[model samples]
Target: MNTVMHRKPKPYRSERTTAHTSDRNASAFPSKRHARRYWILLSLFLFGGLLCSLGLLLYNNPVPVQSPSFWPVVERRITAVTTMAIAALCQSLATVAFHSVTNNRIITPSLLGFDALYSTIQTSMIFFFGAGALIGFSGTKAFLTQVGLMLVMSLLLYGWLLSGKYADLQLLLLVGIILGTGLNSLASFMRRMLDPSEFDILQARLFGSVTNADPAYFPIVIPVVLIVSVLLFLSANRLNVIALGKDVATSFGINHRRSVLYILILISLLMSMSTALIGPLTFFGFLVATLSYQVASTYDHKYVLPMAFSIGFLVLTSAYFFMYHIFNAPSVVSVIIELFGGLIFLTVLLRKRSL
Candidate 1:
């Protein structure tokens, strides 16, 4: 009997396998290194640009550096910086946390009606008490009033909706949208009734203006923003888990309802402070948070949060620099931001084919 030597069969590589291998080999190294490099470069660019914008804000004034008039200019500059910092922190942290809890990058905390609420409050004040009362209510007292009202309303709405056993995120979001719509309608009615003079006065406060921030309110805003932001930062890892969906988060030992309630409360307070401080910023937070995700290219809140803050600061400073110095139209900053942000929102929605 002639025994044939057995030959080992070589593994066959199909076209699909070859293509996949080539794709993986081509993409693997560059993808990772590119992400890392993008993070580093973005951080440097934002930080450096912030510094330059700040320098321009401080020294570009007509006041002589050696004159006694310089101190007042410097004081204004300091206040501007502080306002921008608080706005950046509040908008960045709140929006990022809001997006994580909701698990939707396209939506922002603005859905909660902070901006609409702000407009309603201002309009009501002017409608009933007149523009003089609105002006008189300015400064620290007005800031505190707005923050307190916003915080209480948020607590009432969020607590009642989220503390129950059947806490549903969709339901809560629906209620918020209804409330926002109602508030906006009321504000619109009030605006239509106002005389042109009263409307003019109300319009100034309607826009988001860093210059409108009072330094005295800084004492109140600074601590609240810092403390709440730190709390959110500490929960960053949990936020990552929450973004995975409720069932997955629960399996990981996270109490989905409780965590979401706590995060919502924090977001409310943050949005309140920012809105009370800068008036209504319809799209500032959305813009910053969206850009942060794109620039940082990571879902890890540890990286995303700081990047959001940096990007927020960079955007605010750059806009202020150009608007104040170049166009002398600082009040238009909000308009410009909202215009761009609305465009971005439409683009994102069209691309995703979902809300």
Candidate 2:
């Protein structure tokens, strides 16, 4: 026996092995660097959008004085800009959060009957209490009540669905669709019974509109949005995990049930805020969320959330700017937005891509 000390089988360095190592290294670092670059690009886009909106807001002002004092004009412009920014931020954040919780980009918080409940609540108030009562309805108090009701309803629905043996997301969505239709029918019935003047009042609230937003409501809305955003940011990592499907998440020691519940409550609060602030936007969330995904090309919540918000801000701000300045009709923005958003929905559906 030639006692040749068997050298550990010469490490077989195959071409495949070398290629895999190279691929792994590239994946490990290049994507991260790419994400950073994408973030920078997004930041630049937001800055450019803001400057454009500001320019449009100041274009051809009717103030008696030519080029009024810079500070006062700047102050007013800032106020308008702030309002648009806050509203866009709140809506986008809420929509993205809603999509994440459901694990389906096609489904929005509004689709889960929150907006329907809002409509029913508002319509019922007008029908029973009459239009005059709307004047007495404290905006903050009403908003809180609506949010609370939405939370309860969402919890009940999600919990009930989870408790059942045959529960599935598709079933839940179907139930929501039916419930929403039912609520809309109820609202329409009530509207038909109202007097002509009352019908006019109800009609105004039926469709989505942002023009009626009152500055007084911002005090409450801003703080609520900020708090929710902070909570979302902290849980951003968990959201990314949750997106990998419930089974995988549970294996990773995540409490899937509890996490879903928390997400539902957060979505309800957000839906209530947006509905109260600017009425029901049936397709706006779908439009913005889908568009953001296309633009960002990543599912990381850290990137997706901010990108969605920025896109939402840009779209809404631009729409308002054009309607008020170029079109000389601020009231038409909502209609145009709805029309465009609907077309986007159809286009997306036709493409058959997983939303």
Candidate 3:
């Protein structure tokens, strides 16, 4: 004991302190370089989207720039671009938020039967009321009606399912799937009974395209979207926490169920608006959100949402522009987009091997 050298023990340091290093990186990005890369990528996507939109409005415009008809033609194109912006905003924001809340990157808002409900409504219109009713079942009034119907049903779903002791997301998803499958079967049966001419016309109406949108709904849609989008942006931080799963979110003092319910309501509104605005783009949101995760290279919704919107806008405008002017195949543009989106979906599934 006497021979023991009295050595002052090394001052205690936490693992955090001991491990601190200049090499440490952000959670989402591996290094500072990756953080910088995110901004650079964001800028590029934004610029590309704007360029495509301008090209859509002006490129191959047969009317001379100086002529009187030119402005009118451009004005018409403006409507299409506006529709693209709304659709992009809705899909991107909704999908990203939906992913965060659900804690699942693979499934999309379509899982909740919004798309199925939309399809059923359209098919039922043609089946019961005739194709003429389906044709006339447009304009601003009809648009609002469809949106209202979607929101109402979504509210009922959220309210009824998310309130009990047995409140469970998996349960809700299962119920939605069952409901969707039944509605889909009904719609399919109705479609089969229709005359070929009616079926053809109905088929044309069902395909999502810019031409399907009417500019008159813009005034109503713009205000609602702006309001909801603001709400979402304000909830970005909360979304980040929620994305980490319920247990983690609860430990962090968040009301996981309530937050999820509120967020789901917002998502429903977004999906409804997009579906009403331009029919159902089933995989468009998935495509946008997936590419955004790759391009954003971060878990931050604030940045991811913007990136998704930019990419979506770029995809839609560029696809329509190139298809119409270069390939003269505007009719198949939506088909092409869905095909690519489906292929990408399969690739992701195979790579992950689990949803």
Candidate 4:
């Protein structure tokens, strides 16, 4: 009567079994629903961008669709669209990559002084040679000159600030800021000395706009951008590791300095190309990166980069279409963008309460 009943033995899970079970729920997103959400957002951005692009091309067409002149009209608009795409690609990628390497979300690659350098170059051209010369400074040669100068300056900074025992990222940025301040001051002084008419001419070049981009430069600009863009996209994985900080990245067997240098060079090429082609879009990149982060809701650069690029394309296209077509205030489009971007930046800054 005192006999105990035997209980059924529980099955023991092996480590492999446990790991597999845990991994079954693991994904880029927290769950299946999140994965679905990300994809849906991405698709929406793409679709919206597509619609805006079409609107740019077809809205308010002066020529009839059947007319022989129709395609030419469309072709002319295509230049603007292409310029938007290139700017989006360059700014979005370069900003994201710069943020990753620096491990800071608040600062953009614009802090590296590309914009200042561009302003200085334009100002110098106008200051020394006159407005006529500045006007003549177009075509492939002028485009290449701007790009080459920016790259050379960036390379020199990297070499001087990142190679020695005292090499520090903060130091590099400090120097960049100082240089930018100096260049900006110099440019401002030169502007003050110019006649109103010449100042008027240079003012247009100073503003970041698609009209600043000449299609003639496309022959050289497109190939370089595509190549640098691919290289940056490929570096996305390494960026993810670098974003974890130097200690973590080193533990993962990554050459932290080398990776940082590589990324900086790529960023230089991207920013140089973008600033040269479109002038100083200072906050556009920050705007894209911030929005993309909110939309993507993840830190994976693979997703973040694409999401950034898509949002960038949509933002630029939509902004241009609305301002140029609907609002009929095309000149203020860049100003509008910068305003919103700065507002977003301040909001993010206040929320974080620290840089």
Candidate 5:
């Protein structure tokens, strides 16, 4: 009777609900606008990067060849652009996926011992098989073998850690850091024992340089990248949910473990491709991922991934251009990139933001 006499319940619009509705409305169409803006920015960045690279190519005198026609020059430019583009794409994708899985911006796949493992494997190959043995193998075969070994090692390390009772995200990260340190020590020991000439060859392999990219690897890298890109695009929405943390993602009916595993695999493949193509980039991934996050200002993977790729392409291309053309130091591009990337890394840390 009391309920019957009670005034019709007011529409159940709590303040929180009202606020949520407002937020939803505000963000709804704005994402589309942001998407458009991002595409425009991406196009502009690509143009700038290309222009810089082209300018560098033109300014540099080509090596004298049987054919001095522009076609050869065009081919060289194409090759350079293609290699850099692939490297950037792989690094950016790996970085973004790595951040999503670890739920941390400051960390990159490289930090998790991928690069270290790569170095160890390369050094071991040189030590046991000798430089001559490695030379006997084609570049593509060596690259593929390196990638395969890295993947196996990564899986073993990550799988072992994940199989433990305390294998939470933080634990995985801690283990990664420890493993990376150990691997670095081993690599240092190997380097110290190597002859100066061997060390020179190894030193070039350790740094993230694009100058000596093997063209044969391009065929393998391009297809792998395309396939992974498709997989990533399909899983973008899942990544967004995963970023909300494990419980929320589970609540959303996402298979959190499976999602994480898939993402990790994709990340490892990307890391492998990038490392095999150029060399280990300790900071490039972190730099691009952080910059992309800042520029996008959104946690949605759909926006974040593409933006990261664009930014990476722009950075690498521009760096290559400047180092070659202006500085006349193609060999120093990696150093320059790391210098700026390090500064940005510090800035990000000071701001206390995650990529």
Candidate 6:
């Protein structure tokens, strides 16, 4: 009876095998087309929004539209646009590249104490030379001094913390944070000693504003931003590899240390120019970079970089338009941006459960 019905068993394929095959196919090229399409649509929308914001800023004035006041309004709008553009590029490119090199999302270029150092420079100029010196400090020489100091300081930190057989990025960041805190402390102490009027003047300088940037500085800032941005765009391929980790990057014949060093230097320069121009924007870079990653939905630097710039431009221009036109308080734009960016930072930190 047992031998009577020897039927051949069908070839066996379990549910696990089927599921794994499905997973592999699902992950191999998942959502890439959708991401590309989304980026294209988002790009068009942002560009349109930017143009509308520009129009609002330029043409939506209360003073007589056809009077001599029109020229002043036009001039102011032009300067605002120029400042916003430079700020956008600087924040976008520097933040994206900084994130790539550090491979960390929570921190920003501000960690290196560019803002704190700027505060110190201002406070010291006020504390030692009195607040009136700030007037003289607004010229081109002071701009150059600020850029030079930041460059030298960043260079020293990079060389000190990232040049050994065991280059430790954590140590560098920790030291930077510490120095920044110390510098802030000194500035605060000095601020406390200043007269009310001088302190008020220093306080004004602390707030980042498109109007605060001197037009004379734009000549230098535009060129520096353009050159650094082009360099960053060219290095996108290297940054992509670097994002994979030092070990993986080395495996691909990338000099991980050198690439990182160079990236930091370039980032320092960008931050210096931006900070020197607009004071310290602790959140704009972080906000734009985070939004860029989410909206672009891809890891490729080529796509992400331009997306970051566009988003930054859109955010800055829209903020300027709303604050200057709608709220009648442009000085608070940095505060609003920093507030939202801090909330985003907290949300991301809780969600990721890791730095």
In model 2, the runs with Cα more than 4 Å from the true position are: 1-37, 64-80, 163-171, 344-355
TM-scores for all predictions:
0.86, 0.82, 0.90, 0.92, 0.85, 0.87
The sequence of per-residue lDDT tens digits that candidate 3 reaches over residues 1-355 is: 5446445444666455567865564566666787798888888888888998898899999989889999999999999999999998998899999999988887788888887888899999999999899999999888888999989988888888899898888778888888888888988899999999999988877788888888889899888888898899899889999999999999999999999999999899888998888888888998889878876777788878888888888888888888888899989989988887778767866786644
Name the lDDT value of residue 6 in candidate 2: 54
Range of the 10 consecutive residues with the lowest summed lDDT in candidate 5? 22-31
By TM-score, who's the top model here? Answer: 4
For 1-355, candidate 4 gives per-residue lDDT tens digits of 2334334333666465777785675355766777788999999998999899999999999999999999999999999999999999999999999989998888889888999999999999999999989999988889889999999999999999999899788899989999998999999999999999999999999999998889988988899989988988888789989999989999999999999999999999999999999999988998899888777877788889899999999999999999999999999999998887678767866886644
Better of 5 and 6 by TM-score: 6
Q: Quickly count the clashes in candidate 6.
A: 0
Q: Model 6, residue 138: displacement in angstroms?
A: 1.2
**lDDT tens digits, residue span 1-355, model 2:** 3355454344768566877785564221147666776778689769867866776657756564455575576555655666667667766777787777677877776878877887798789889999987656656677677767877777788878855687666677788888888998998788789899877876777566665465667788788878888788778888888878888898999887778767766776777777776678777777888877766767677887888888777778787778877888876777888787778767865775655
lDDT for position 275 in model 3: 88
Better candidate by lDDT, 4 or 5: 4
**Each candidate: what lDDT?**
0.83, 0.74, 0.86, 0.91, 0.79, 0.84
Per-residue lDDT over 193-240 for candidate 5, one digit per residue giving the tens place of the 0 to 100 score? 877887777777778787668777888889999899879978888888
Where is model 3 poorest over a 10-residue stretch in terms of lDDT? 1-10
Clashing residue pairs in candidate 6 (N, C-alpha, C atoms within 3 angstroms) = none
Which wins on lDDT, candidate 1 or candidate 3?
Answer: 3
Point out where model 6 deviates above 4 Å.
1-32, 63-65, 342-355
Better of 1 and 5 by lDDT: 1
Q: Which stretches of candidate 5 lie over 4 Å from their true place?
A: 1-37, 61-68, 163-167, 345-355
Error of 4 at 177 (Å): 0.7
